[model samples]
Target: MSEAVDWGLALATGVRTASSGPEMSMTEAAAEVAALREAAAAVVEPVAGITALSAPEAPPAVVVDRAEWIRSNAGALRTVLTPLTDGERQVGGFAQPVSSRLAGLQLGLALGWLSGKVLGQYEALPAESDGPQRLLLVAPNIVQAATVMGVDEHDFRLWVCMHEETHRVQFGAHPWLSEYFAGEVAALVRGLDVGPAELAARLASGIRNADSGGVAGWLQSPQMRSRMSGLMALMSLLEGHADWVMDQSEEVVPSAARLRVAFEQRRRGGGLFDAVLRRLLGLDAKLAQYREGAAFTRAVIDQVGLSGFNKVWSGPATLPLAGEINDSTAWVARVRSM
Candidate 1:
């Protein structure tokens, strides 16, 4: 069957759209990369200690520019969306090539826009796959964000490593998580087999309800509702846990407190156009995940201590439900009972 998205086109378009930022000479960029790698390595033990999660000896973090970031994520996207793009099912009406190109262009544009915003990411590899799991630090974006926030660049780099390293530990500690997340993504993509008319209706409905749930409301179809919620809850748990742990970095990072203040301000500071773009891209929802997830993390840790809070990684059953994310008491009670 014909592919649904031209992955090559997506990569090219994304790279082109993601303009470079925070100019650096070759030596400066190399120095930043080396420093970030060392920081990532240094944080592994601390993150494991803070969360009481043990990760296997992992490879050093790969530091890249914006274009490389886009390329790496584009490849991951293709892997996740393979069920929809490579199977017998296809988005109806448009010819195979036309549909593929359109999908690629759309995906490319979104990735391009996001390339500038992300600082570091932990890309979980499939359990059965041979490729080594990757922890990526976007060097230029990290420098740019630090410069924009006016914080100590070295401190900020280590701070970002703390959060990203937490994610690495989260997945590494629970090997099943990568496969589980991949399965859910496949199920969600497979559910998007609707024709153009149904897709259009869904889009209209999504736009109307965008304010209510951000990306969840916008992209949700009946078939994808449960999967989306599960994924969102998992993401909330992961991101929130990382954020909470990163806050405890004041001991090692002297400027951690100041960095947090500046970062939060920057997260909340944006123009009208930026706001619109954020809402459209579900970044607003992402921000909520950080806030709500961190609140839930703090509340649980406060109530039951870090050991009890670590129960969240026990299994999928221990993960917070969609409603439970906003209700820490409910999550705490449910997990304790389980």
Candidate 2:
């Protein structure tokens, strides 16, 4: 069978289309990189203290341009889809180069567009087998976003670091998390091997449910419903937890309140075309995760205190269910029983 995706083509296409925001001289870029690295380092202790979770010291954060961010994500996508391309559950058809190329192009377009918007990401997948996990900070995007939001660059950078650092701490603190996440992704990919008829039906169902689930709802297939729900819940928890931690560290970021207000406004900003694109990309759903997840975290903490809330980090079973995210009382009751 042909490769499921022409990763090289995808990388090239993405790099070509990705926006290079706020051109900077080599000196400016270097200085921004240095500042971001410092911010990432500074957040470690505060994040650990606030969350009561310790992340093992890892390598320094990698600061990349928009094109480089696309490249890194392309590589990670390849790693994730390997099972579908090369393992026992290989997706049928697409043996022709044209088919693979088309898939690559579609993926490339999405990644290229997204490269400009993301501020930072915690890459749990190593570049090479046995390589250390990395925290990637997109310097150009960060600089551009801060300018657009009219916030202090230093404070905004630190604020973004706090959120991304929480992700690093999450995976590092729980060794099983990365593997579990990967496994769920692999399972979902494997489930995509259905025939055209079933695939269409699933897509139709997803569209119908889009009002409720966003893009993620449209992407879900019946076979993968349970797995997708669990994965979504996990993502909601991670994003929400990170946001909560970032807000709690206002002492460190004196402009935290101002930044949050601007950031929320920014998340809600953008014209009609942008709004449609965000929904298509599941970004709207992602924004909901932050809101819903943070609310759940706040409720849980209020009800049980921080230590009791910490029970979530124990394992997969301890995490909230999709329904429970909105109803934290149910989550608290269930976990207490556990």
Candidate 3:
């Protein structure tokens, strides 16, 4: 296949039947999704204290299957990875073709696996020509997760909606964030100088050194470190804020406590293939995103109150730096000083 081949579609379409079916019919699923969307929207502003752009312009939420989620994100991923595929450093070499093919194959495998794990995602795109950005709930995965956690289906779905809707309000309140995040991703990709040979060598070495945190430790150059620091800080802020908002709904999901416990255990309970994927994708660090970031958000809110904590949304500069993500006091001091 040519470098421009549609690997995302190929991979996504290949295993469409692997994901489990939802408990309800398609029509019933749509109706329930709509109801849940309204339910989640009702709490958005009150819980987040981040107002939507306009009542009508709020991000539209959709219920999608695992394949749809994969396909939607794949479009974004392809756009982001184009620079890598066509990089200046990707000159002709003995292993150039293999390296490129490996990159494609690994990405396909990762997405296919994650298709079963992710319950929701918020795609903060620039307003499309036809509509605003959409928040997606992957129905099958949500059902599966609810089943796995043994939580009430209704309660679990609503809980997931709240978290995903909080993400919508976050971007809707600050439309600039979509551009800012996209810029960060572009800048990080632009900074990569991976030659074909290095790419091949890294992949080949990945399995042999899986114990030392795999690619993470191997790819710890200063530039990569800086990029990851910025990226992680941003993600922690987004994710932590979402969790904080979700917990603030009018009616609490009593099972949320147990759900959290189940999720924490799940993160630590992956098999070897899962572990290898986490290492390769640097998702191991995401474990800290939940724990440390939530701790930071909770501490800031406790000290400053919700209104004062809104200072984080005042500007990107107020967002916690990497070191400060684990040190809420430091972030509080910095924001308050400003």
The prediction achieving the highest lDDT against the true structure is 2
Candidate 2 vs. true structure, TM-score: 0.86
- Tens-digit lDDT track of model 3 for 67-175: 7766665566555545555645445542345555565555555555566767777776422323456778777777777777777877777778777777777777776
Q: How far does residue 14 in candidate 3 sit from its true spot (Å)? A: 5.7
Per-residue CA lDDT of candidate 1, range 39-94, in tens? 88888877888888898888889888888877777776656556544434454543
Please list the C-alpha lDDT of all candidates, in the order they appear.
0.71, 0.74, 0.61
lDDT of 2 at 315: 85
- Stretches off by above 4 angstroms in model 1 are 86-88, 125-130, 193-223, 268-286
Runs in model 3 with CA error above 4 Å?
1-18, 22-35, 45-56, 93-102, 125-132, 195-224, 250-255, 267-286
Q: What is the C-alpha RMSD of each candidate to the true structure, in Å?
A: 4.6, 4.8, 4.9
RMSD of 1: 4.6
The whole-model C-alpha lDDT of candidate 2 against the native structure comes to: 0.74
Best by TM-score: 2
RMSD of 2: 4.8
- Superposed by TM-score, candidate 1 places the C-alpha of residue 163 at a distance from the truth, in angstroms, of 0.5
Please give the range of 10 consecutive residues that has the lowest summed lDDT in model 1.
269-278
